[model samples]
Target: MTEMTLDPRQLGTGGLFTAAVPDLASHEAAYGRRPSGWTRSPLLRELEASGLAGRGGAGFPAWRKLAAVGAGRPAVIANGAEGEPLSRKDTALLRQAPHLVLDGLVTAGEAVGASELFLYATAESLPGVGQALAERRDGPRVTLVEAPAAFISGEASAVVNALETGTALPRDKAARIARSGYQGRPTLLHNVETLAHLALVARYGAQWFRSAGTADDPGTRLYSLSGDVPAEWVVEAPGGASLRDVLRLGGAEPSSLAAVLVGGFHGAWVPAEAFDLPLTARGLARYGASPGAGVLLALARGRCGLQASAGIVRYLAESSARQCGPCMFGLPAMATVLERIAAGERAPWLASEAERLAGLVTGRGACHHPDGSARFVRSSLGVFKDEVRAHLAGACTAHHGRV
Candidate 1:
């Protein structure tokens, strides 16, 4: 598939708006060099003080992450592993604006006093990033590492683990990769888009960068909008913009809306009536959701929310590495129950089983899979209670025995 070109200005400072870059070659020229303003810039310090969070789903503070690996011969990992099937923004950015991404990685390494740069990407994305890196001979020391294609393998720590051990798998502990990553050296891991933003911010300074986004969360973000949307493409928008605005940008029909799933499979389902809600880490939390990886799956009115939830559950279950006991046993059982429920089977007890499984998996795994799965399933039950009740009453009109 030919990669779409995005306008650098679309990635510009005015909140989230569509800008087209056209193609890779054009984007490289636009990327040029690190903005001279970044030299001796205190933006990283301000970003730390400003509490800029990771846009790559976790929402962890960027400054804290950088601070975690204080001045040293640290290594920087530009995590470009876009694992969610629904998310294409990261890979799209890499393929289209590889130079921008490379510039960000180099600038970030320089900011944190890191000497080594490792750009970790899925095998599918390796070629694009590698080519981009090859064009740059004046940047910081760098290497491109291809990670295995797996769902959870793209998590920040997982990327670090894979780079160090040459294994594309998540570790069995909540290991702080910043403390000891990449040959037991302090490492700073960030999403490709996040670093790209850093490159610009480092050049423009915080005030100039802050002019485009919300006060609390300053900057633009890329969202992957799909399902029942007319304009199903990656969108660039300002942080804390209303969800309604994003939906409109995606060209979603008013009648096609039912509930919108913010975040990915691990996110929550908010009724479409609440589309006016702002899109922010804290705002989504008010609705019992996190913008996990910036995926917005809009379900149409006729679509069965429970069945949709079931399909996602099955996917998450199958994606599990099976390293943790709770995730191994609980996710499969939960998916089975969701499958039965989606099939219109009268398994009232299955709901209880899902709840029980959620309890077991919430915080018991080495990774966030179990927690994420629990959130996905638990939120489905909460959001689709009426549907579950209808299925139990043998009156489910959606997906009757289709599973």
Candidate 2:
């Protein structure tokens, strides 16, 4: 596994992964103990005022998720299942700053009057998280479960499913996790990073939480920066940070980039021309991208974007839960077409076929798996139009043999 790297200068002061806080004792010493005894209303108000959004993609307001579980003995889950292949931020946080996440989990449980608390994470992160839990002197007991390595396992519904049914597949969309979750209780599922931010918000209040980022997007976010860089680095960036600056922080030269796949395998591509834009949802909207889980995969100048996209799409297609026709049939079909296109298929209708298949699979799954895969495929077709053309003409313009 690639070791996660951090740069304090890029993180600014009081960022999540500080050098001062390595162990549980150091964590409490640096940030002080988490203040206890919060009720629903005040906590929700503070979270709303903080303008914090979910870091686990979808960008939903954190307060809204909490509020949705109103008037119930809800379950709170700290989700550290970093299933995205390019994402290491959650894992890094869980390993290096486990106490902070534990504090958040306990804090959220208190605020919501939770009946039970759970911490779900990747296998590699379990030992550290378990150790951190052992060190806590006065927090609510938290149950820890090892998360499966599948890409879809981290989806909100899927996380609930895994704990309840021992299956990592996503549950039906009709039953929202907040309304009906594990063991038929209202559950407040938050990404581990989101929970960590909640811990800070609980301690420092909304204003302090909002001190770093923009008015619309407050607080700092950990970005998993990789591809054509010196190494995979998990760098903390302020919300709505410039994409170019983030890549530079990861040691990527702006000029050498062909494009970036913002978000993870399910995300869209933004060409090099738009690298200067902010990483916020609003900033990346025009390019059909978002800061989904803060995953930024840079495409070097000589790489074949279509080939790179095809491989990811193929992986996503195979990663499907297969409970829906779109995932079971449509995604594989779409992947096959995309793979053909990447392999320099001269058929004039190949590109259109891929689009047709994307349209077919989109929004027709039991989950958003098909939709996200479609978005990735569609974005590739648009961003790599030149490459598509070259491949159709029996040539690969990127000259790297394969992307």
Candidate 3:
């Protein structure tokens, strides 16, 4: 496993050690509080005022989501089904700070007038989270559900489908799960970490929460910082911190990094020269990237970018749910182009084929698969222009294995 370094200044109070399970009695004594003062605190409003964004990939405003679900008979979902292969932040939170996550679920349920809470995780994640839920006596009104471990199956709609009918498959776009989820009720689905933040906001108040992050996007975010560092660890830092700061905090050598993949496979690629960029959604947008799912992969210079991208493309292609024509057909075609490019093949029609497939897939699928696949291939071509050129030139003989 590659080592990753995290900067201390960018980290939250407990930093990397925050996820370590503390003594239950001590944790309860310090964190456990009866559900009271709900109306007085105006927790949801305060969270909106504080500008707390979701720690999940999309960085959606937490308050906005709460307001969307408002005080009604809504359903709250803790999305622990982290489908990204390279990311483990959610799993770590579920395993270590399960109580905190549950607290957030309960708080969100209260704020949104949601009486029912559901905790959904991949089948592999069920045991740990289930045990954690069993240990808690007075938290949210939640039920644990185990979803299929397929990559796309962990998506929100897929989770909802699994919860409703025990089928871990994504529904058609026309039938968005949020509009009619879990027994036909309005639902507010959030990542487990997002709910945990809500619990903290409810307990500490939003001003304190806002004190750490940026002016626009407040509160901390958990990132699975991997590759080219001293330690591969999960780090929590305030939103909008400099990527440079995060790299340094993760003990990564600033100069050696060739590029950073800001989001997971679905995110854009940014060259190392852009490290000075802030880690907020707005900051990343300037670079045509978003920290989707908070995965930062550092690539070394000698590594072939085409090879790295080809591996991810293959993974995405294989992970396709095969529910739609575009995603089912287009991803494999894109994967073939990437593999050929990585292998130093200059098929005259490769570029155009990729573009055609990208066009065919974009926005045609029920999920973001088409868009994410397109972005992955498009960013690879743009960021790895030199590599694509080299492959066309037949210059590099070494093929770096999958990333």
Candidate 4:
């Protein structure tokens, strides 16, 4: 794989999880620094100053989680569940930067006085994480858990629930996982990317971590670039890099994009005209999207946006845990309407019906599944206005809405 970095601000560092720096020793050499060791107070201070946010779609502050698991010998979980269908960055990080992730885990464990460190990773990704763990000589009492490869199973709460009871369903009411998680112990759970950034911050301090990105949200991110690309590639970029520049790393020029899915299934859509949008939290906030799971799926010029969203809606609906009424039922209904719209619905009312269904589904579920699906459905209807018009007129305008 040709590793291309779009950040352009090296900040006296090298590629994060690139193939050339394949393993632990190489990562150490590439980064050229490591934290001596971490203690709680100073570690929390530095992390707070770094202003790192969770990279697992939710942009929650890293310091908030680290600080919230207050004054206990809690547990730490490195989440590599890769539940989002459009995301592959976690697997790549497991394969290439596993040690850095583990180092961050160790640092976090030390800072929080964690007794056990658990890693939740997919079956395909477990081997990589296992290999990295085997090569490590020192760390906390670490355990390896094989995570189910389901979308919702990767939820932070679900991971803890799976570890505790062997049932991987998110809790109905979401509590602060940091304060109370995994056997009712104060736990520090974070995505693998966030942990990797923690390792950087632990070694380099907050300012060094802030050297590359914007002031409000500083540091780098790994984005899984899929769809309409020569090949799937993970691009490393600063917080606020332009969407156009990031997409180019996957061979997607702005002119080639019909519409881009800015976040994961729960994310919003941005028309090609909005290609100038940045990839940060604030940047995406302007467009009403977050860096959810760091997935940037670019739809090519000839693809039908309706068809793409319809399939995803159906998949998300099927993946639901079936615990929530609005999600389990409402989502399937919305998916049906999206499928109808995708199949060149001649009824002009179908669009309004979709809008109605999406509105009904939003905010009604116990989880964000319904909300995100509604966003995907609603955003597709807006971004693919031309396709919607064509479908109403009984035509697909482009490729008969295939894929």
CA lDDT of each prediction against the hidden true structure: 0.75, 0.84, 0.74, 0.80
lDDT of 1 by residue, 1-403 (tens): 2222233353532222224432345553454446643432365576764445787888787777776785567899888888887887887777656666777787778767787899888777788676766666666668888877678878766787788787777775566778877777888999888887777666655665677668866777788888877657787777777778877766666556788889988889988777777787677665688665788898988789988899999999999888888768899999989888877787688788889989988889888889988988989988888788887666664444333
Q: Candidate 4 on 1-403: residue-level lDDT in tens?
A: 3345555333214555455425667767767645756888898899899988998878888888887895566999999998887788888777767788888888899888888899888888787777777777665557989888888888888889999988888885568777788878898899988898898888878998888777865788788888887777778877777788778766667797787788788898877777787776577674577777789888888888888889998998899999988777888998998899888867899999989988898878766778888888878887788888988887886676432
At residue 95, candidate 4 shows an lDDT of 74
TM match of model 3 to true structure: 0.90
* RMSD to truth, every model: 3.2, 2.2, 3.3, 2.6
Evaluation by lDDT, superior candidate among 1 and 3: 1
Better of 2 and 3 by lDDT: 2
TM-score leader: 2
> What is the number of backbone collisions in each predicted candidate, taken in the order shown?
11, 0, 12, 2
- lDDT (C-alpha) at residue 312 in model 2: 93
The predicted structure with the larger lDDT, 2 or 4, is 2
